[model samples]
Target chain A: MNAPVLAVRNLTKLFADAARPDAMPVGVRGVSLEVARGEVVGLIGESGCGKTTLGRCIARLLDPDSGEVLVRDVPFSALKGHSLRNFRKNVQVVFQKPETCLNPRMTVAVFVREALRNFGIVANNAEARKRLVELASLVGLREAALEQYPHQLSGGERQRVAIMRALACEPELIVLDEPTSALDVSVQAQVLRTLKDLQTVVGTSFLFISHDVAVIRYMCARVLVMYLGVVVEEGPVEAVFGRPAHPYTRALLAAAPRIKPRAVDPIALRGELMLGDVRLDECPVRVRCPLAHARCVEAPPEFDLGDGHRSACWLSADTASRSVSPTAMKAAS
Target chain B: MSADAPLFQIDGLTIDSIRADRRRRIVQDVSLCVAPGQIYGLVGESGSGKSVSMMASVGLATTGLAVQAGTVRFGGVVQQAVDQRGLKQNLSHGISLLFQNAKGALSPFLATGAQVGRVLDRQAIPRADREARISELFRVVGLNHADLGGKYPHQISGGQAQRVAMACALATDPKLLIADEPTTALDVTTEREMLRFLKRLCEDRGLAIILVAHNLSLVSEYCSGLSILHAGQVVEDGDLGAIFDEPLHPYTQGLIAAVPDVDEPHELIPIAGSVWGGSADIDRCRFSHRCPFAMPRCDAGIPTGIRTRGRNVHCVLYDEAAS
Candidate 1:
């Protein structure tokens, strides 16, 4: 098999709260994942769940406290100076807010050309202009928009420019952090379609990070459901969203509003999410889980559910041992 | 007022923005009716005039904007919408507003309890009963009064702060509440909880709510009736179920198709162009420029509302005389 484009193992990044020393730090915790070449992997969670932190760590924008990030089997930490600069070309990031990331003074063409020149993707000005036009069309940007500044562009156009800049490097992997959340529904659809088409045409792996469940389901072949800095569930999109094993995942799916009214009542959780309320030794979601049990006091290990599906919950063990369905278990609880 | 009469109604509401001595109609011929205990949704994108129309209906249209025409009826009392003084009086008559950003709307210097108390004070509840009413309002909104009352806005979570805003809105025992994108700042779970709570409030108190939002799915889940606004004009209005089942307007169809569904994945077909805010005096369909089926006559005049499929749709395609 060909090597995966990006591989992360036991990645941990914690931010210390100096004002509240006793409070648990907020950031990504011991995350492990693999993004095969041309694969779209989704990371979904509510605010402060560390999905963004994980994306930043994978993109090397922020250094993780421990663990390894590998690009095509090459350790990200081992690269230095010129080698690191060359290696960085393999991964790119598109932030949530394009306005802040884009330079206000540069036209769309100049902004994209900067990436090309920095990576030496184009040798001459003529080639750079040609590449800029190609990248713009690839991302569904009008050739005319390349001449306008970021401030002159619409929200959707600005985001497309950001994506174009990232694609300029011809990176093997791109980390998109809530790329379409700020866009209108119509504009968001256009951008998401463009991204999907670009992925197919360019064959670039995408680490799609978003809080919108439906978007993640639409864009990703596989998904990781995170909660309080831990991945509670991971599997094929169908296996995870269709037959979610973790209670948190079930609650999240239930909570998301659907265009078609849901047939059943949403599973109401116990309370609002309170960060730093649980110790690392305990399950991060037990405080809010309606079906939490005594076994949930301790952190559960990820149980393999076949088809590459895995869930970190003690109830999955019961489902495996007693052949009890998760729904039946919930009723019993 | 009769029990069956709409709690709040706005007819032929028109608004114009005066910028550098030039007049441009921002909202024109907008109309909406909300019956008691109904959750009516006003869905549109930003700058589409959902907020502007609602604000003007309540006489809170921002400076530099003029209310040109229309009539507002509250509790069977009719008054011209252009009468800002008369419309401002509606605020005291069982009408409350909840904005998008709860934290920013809240008074930073005051405790949550004091904020709620201030509303009661304005309503002239005797000083003796103000504290009890504040606590009751907190409980009604599902907040622990003893815990959150004394805390400042910054001390509470987004959901809690919004509930605090809800408590303030409810302090007057309002018959009609205008909540403009109330849950846009909240997480999905919290957003659902808030909407569910609002539904319960309507059921328990016979309260009518005007839920203004840019999200179609969110409104579809909670609102019974809705009006789709485009470039300040309501292009579609009526039964939510009917609109969802068979949307008639081109703009409505495009908006629904653009939304991504969690339960069912389908190809998204975005509208071709952004909304074009034309001159108020032009008297044409605001959505014609973006409409796929735009015709030469669509440029002639505004498409009047046509009744079909248990709803009202404004489009040339629906005009019996045109086609």
Candidate 2:
């Protein structure tokens, strides 16, 4: 098989609290994932669960303290000067707030053209103009809207412009960090549909990061559940969401407000997410896990559950071997 | 008051934002009747005037906005909505409001406990019982008074700050609580917890709540009845279950179709055009521009509510007499 478009190896980044230096720094820790060519991989987590940090780190917007991000087997950090600048063209990032990310002074056309010219993606003004129109249409923006400034456009339009700017570079992979969370449901639907179609047309891999589980389920083929800086569960979207292995994943799915109510009672988590010292030896979610046991004091390895599904919980070992139901395991515990 | 009587009622409410001698009607002919201990949802998009209607109903309409017409009936007393003083007096009677940003709403200088204490002081609770009452309020919202009471708003997490805000709103033992997107800033689990807490408060204290939110699914889960507002008009209002099951209005159907369902994966059909806020005096259906089945009659005037299928829907297609 061809190499994955983007591969992150044991990436770790921590933000030291200057005011409270002794407090445990909060950020991604020893997280690793890969996005195959043209694949959409989703990262789901609550606020401050390090999903955003992970996205930023992968996009190289924020330098990681450790680990390496490789683009098609080429390490990002190994590239230097001109090579590093060239490597950046392979990945682009779309932030949550379009108003903040976009330049108020520049029109949508000029904003997108800047990216095209900066990367030398277009030969001349004629080509840039043509590319700008193409990019705008790709993200569902009308040609007329390209002439308007960020302030003149609506929230949905501004977001589409941001996406257009990212696509201007013709990057192989795009990191979308809560791209549609700020939008209204109707507008969000339009943007998501546009994105899904754009992905197929462009064949660009997407690392979709969002707190909304329903969106992740809809957009991604594979899913990773993050908690307190680590991936607790990772697998096919159907296998993971349909039959979640981790306790956090179950609680998150249960907590998501659904149009159709669930047949069974939602799995109630214990308490709110508390950010403290990151103890690598212990399970990150043990404090909130309803079925947490003494074995959880020591961190569990990623137990393979076949079909490429893996969960960082000791209980999965019984399920993999004995095919014991999760409910039965909960009952036993 | 009778057990079944509405705790709070707003009738034919209209609000106008006046600037430079020009008046733009922001909220028009909006009405809602919330019974005691009932959770009524006011669901709409940003410019739909959900917040404006609620604020004007309580006489807290911001600067440059004039309450042109409406009457608010609370507990057996009826007063004109234009009477600011009369509406303001209802706060003392039993009305409390909760905003989306709990931290911004809270006093930064005051400790969490002191904030709740200040509300109690305003309500004329005995000075001797203020501290105990504050602690009880905190506990009631599922926060530890001893641990979080002394912390300022900035020190605590978002969830704790929201609980502190909830405690302050509950200080007067309010009969009607107007929570405007209270859980929008919270995490999914935390939002669920907060909504559940609010539901329990309604059941235990007979607290009537008007939950104003832009999220249809969140409102669908907790609220028994709801009013879907669009461009300052009540497009649909009635039982939540009936509307969710068979949405009559085109805009309502578009909204329900737009929301992504977690349990069921289906194609999302977004409304073609954005919300259009029509001119104040036009009196036409604001949603007519985006309505797929728009007819010439839709341009004539804003369709009044037509009772059908156990709900009130305002649309030309639902007009039985016209048909």
Candidate 3:
């Protein structure tokens, strides 16, 4: 569309063990996805599936071992020193644990002020407080909340504070790293609403990361599903979530509760990981795919199902025609 | 009001906490009843003290806050107000806990089956039946018993580990299961499977449960009766249907309003304030300060009574005059 506000290309981040360089420490392999301008993209996967690491790397919080992260056509990996500072000002992040992320020693006002001061968004305390209030108001936080410490604020309020702090610099992109997972359901809604409202008003691109499919489906218009640090499926939120072409995506949809449990709901994966510790000759998801035949283990390629939908599974093209297109998938734009 | 006698009854329990030498109400006079086979869901936000109340009733919460005044009558017998041995004994064989993080709950070195077996052994089950019982429990929780029980905590996936934890809980066929954020650590699909399995197992075996969690829709979909805890107080308690369709309490309304519905993507209107921990100024309604629909009389009188719809609401909004 608009050449995505953020574009990632072959972004692979590896955590090589200090003791054993060959050994991978949790986040391994490499992958890349992008967020379009004024678009909410959900990165959905299980815990420790590299979604968090991807968000961090996009926000430039974690340097990729060997991958490229591009913000607005500018390769962030290519930046250094002052250029990196400019890149940092363009992209910001909000963590899952808002209270822990916040400085308990600082008041809510000071927290927002730190971001503004660091980014040169404001010069004086009065101006900083003014901007902080505007940011706080966007998230439905109270004036009195500014005076209170992180500990004094409620879980929801603390999250709002985190969002305000993230927005203090007025970045073009925000890495929402399970921003509301720690919040109460009610507070989570409020924070998400604030995020959506902020996006509508600011036109900021969001790389929303969450393990909750329903939440991702609700907040994001496009989504990319991750498995073991690899992008197995990526497509429009409605299309992919409605009728997941990928076997893993289909399995995840089947596993999600809400609708009545199906007597014979097909599981996406067969057992364990798509690709074990060692890569197979076949597709990573094939070992778990119900449709996996002898063709599975032989390096299955991602099938282009058109309509901006792509899946890294051999059976996607064959099975996409048969799977039920859930009505929830059609509820999106 | 539904069914009289239940497997476990936490009647009018109040837990007072002393933080920095200050006495405060952490769980204020919460009373709930879980039927023999019913899943009595206790839903609320982080500070709602859902965890503390459940833990305290079973003598598992923070140490300082004593059960100021309440009775935990399990198996139709009144245990001491806060006896470690008594509550634990009542909770051990009679009830078991399942946390969201099962990996942390288990030992890294020991086999998954060994963990479950150890618990069964502690409950007087013979060691010889451990493998059979472990397999049964594993199958019950949807794990591949034939292959994975011998594996360690790290051996299984998140969903598998959670099932292993569930297997450990089911080792004794305990009368009641206390699952605190059980599926919080699992993926959405795995979480869905776990929920279905747990609910089905409970129904099939008549296993009563005290399911304490923060998810309202899940509780609404599964639990029959629930108590909404807020700032150490149960602001609302009744049938899930009534609470969702027509909530009487402001806090309850606020909570329900916050859930981002799948069909309806409305922005979340988060509850305005934080929960008071160990605060002595709990004379008025615990939610009075943040209740947008609060009345002047609310500051003067603390609301603690049943609503018109046969539901308990500890708020001034339910007062006859306010109504």
Candidate 4:
């Protein structure tokens, strides 16, 4: 296919633990992924699972300690000054909390207009006003909303402004970090529909980061399941969700609350995510994985499970041979 | 309709507020009856007044709001009024509350153990037995007393802190627990664990719980009965199985259709029009403006509750069924 819109290779970030200076906390450890043009790729993980950090790294909001972020065959990590500013205009980010992200003093109109001005998209005042109105209409916001301040607008309205601002410069790739988690379900639906419509109209790829599995299933065609800063599974949404190869992926799918109860009770994942220390050699989810073995101490390689499905687990390595019985799997959890 | 009286019951609960010199009904004619050992759900979106109604029932409604009409009865004892101080004094014996943010509800200065111990102290438990009782409560909520007891509120994780809060709530051995979005702030796994613990608690202790949450799926799984609120009015309330499987009210249908189901993915159609929270005519149907099947008669008068199958739905569409 044509060059992917966004490609990240071995991105790693380390933060020092205040109490234990010797232990280095890996925010995004050696994460490599790609998002094709117009594709809505989902990144799912619990809080502090490095999904947000990875998104920020891709958007260049946070400088990665090491590795490369390429935007359409261009090495984004190497760009500096004017070129970097230009690169930033192509990639925009919408955070989880809209109230904090939006300026309290700025009106909805000025927010979108300011973004257009930063990108140098509008020629004059007339052009900026027209563009701002168009962006507002695109996100299903009324013209009256443009006159209101951030505090005056409702949660759903403020989020619309945030989305409009992200779309102000016509960014090719938008990173949405838990955009709907804050809004009520009814309001979330409206915002999600707007996002889907805009993506189709603009052909902008989305790196959607959310802990809500249901939202991810609805919006994303492909998904990456992260555990402790490492992606344990990556594949087509249907393939991965239908037959999850990794233990972590299984736990997540099982944990998600469904409208209708499942035929069999879902396996409840016991224990919390173990953070701190550098167990670089071993699998990140090994501590919580039910099928963890002695071989897990040494990092498990990403095993191909056919049809572009891959999982980082020792049990999945020999799944092609069907050596591990179903009973063995049930006994472990 | 159980042989015995409900553990907690509220009827014709109407709360009004004066904003901008205009009287508005914030919670209008909302009612619920929770039987012992039954986990009843009060499901609604923000500004729906689900939280307000619960707060009013417990005499916790903030100032400026008055209960014009409503009777709260707990264990055959009728409360004087919605905001009567005696309601708390009488109900405090068997009613406890759990909020969304356990960390915020907990005192920053006190140790986790001391917090739970404080509740036991009010019950007049001997000082010598308080320590052992606190540890038992901790163990019941799946927490380790020895390790987490001494730590301050900031020291524990969100899930662990929530469990500690649960322990504190259970200290009074309450017969009825009013949990408002207890798992909303927690992770999916943690939420499930907490809900399961709650379900078990209901079965083992025969405790009745009023779970107020926005997530329909979470409420459906644990709660046997539910009430769906919209703009301060309970549009639908009854058996969870009936309301969820075949929602009658357009608002209830819209709310369910809006949530994306992971197990059964489908196109989510959001309800049109924002919830009208302003002072609408009390005689008219509140959701009539947003209802897709709105008729001229809907604006004529308020629609009373009509029984269909096994639930009560307040909608003009069900007028024929009521007749």
Question: Residues A8-51, candidate 3, lDDT per residue (tens digit)?
Answer: 87666755446555533446345667778889889988766789
Model 4 DockQ vs. reference: 0.74
Which tens-of-lDDT digit does each residue in A243-275 have in candidate 4? Answer: 988888888888888888786764556677646
Q: Report, for every candidate in turn, its global Cα lDDT versus the true structure.
A: 0.88, 0.87, 0.75, 0.85
Clashing pairs in 4: none
Worst 10 residues of 1 chain A by lDDT: A324-333
- Give residue A213's lDDT in candidate 3 (0 to 100): 78
Root-mean-square deviation of each candidate, in angstroms? 3.8, 3.7, 5.3, 3.8
Off by over 4 Å in 1: A320-333, B1-4, B277-281, B321-323
- Model 2 alpha-carbon drift over 4 Å, by segment: A321-333, B1-4, B277-281, B321-323
Deviation in angstroms for A224 in model 2?
A: 0.8
Provide the global lDDT of candidate 3 against the true structure.
Answer: 0.75
Give the per-residue Cα lDDT of candidate 1 at B194.
97
Give stretches of model 3 more than 4 Å off: A1-3, A16-32, A105-114, A117-149, A257-279, A291-295, A298-307, A313-333, B1-4, B80-85, B89-91, B124-139, B142-146, B277-284, B300-323
> lDDT at B8 for candidate 2?
87
Clashing pairs in 2: none
Candidate 4 residue-wise lDDT, B19-51, digit = tens: 678788888998889999999999988888888
Docking class of 3: acceptable
Alpha carbon lDDT at B108, candidate 4: 96
Computed on C-alphas against the true complex, the DockQ of each candidate is 0.76, 0.79, 0.43, 0.74
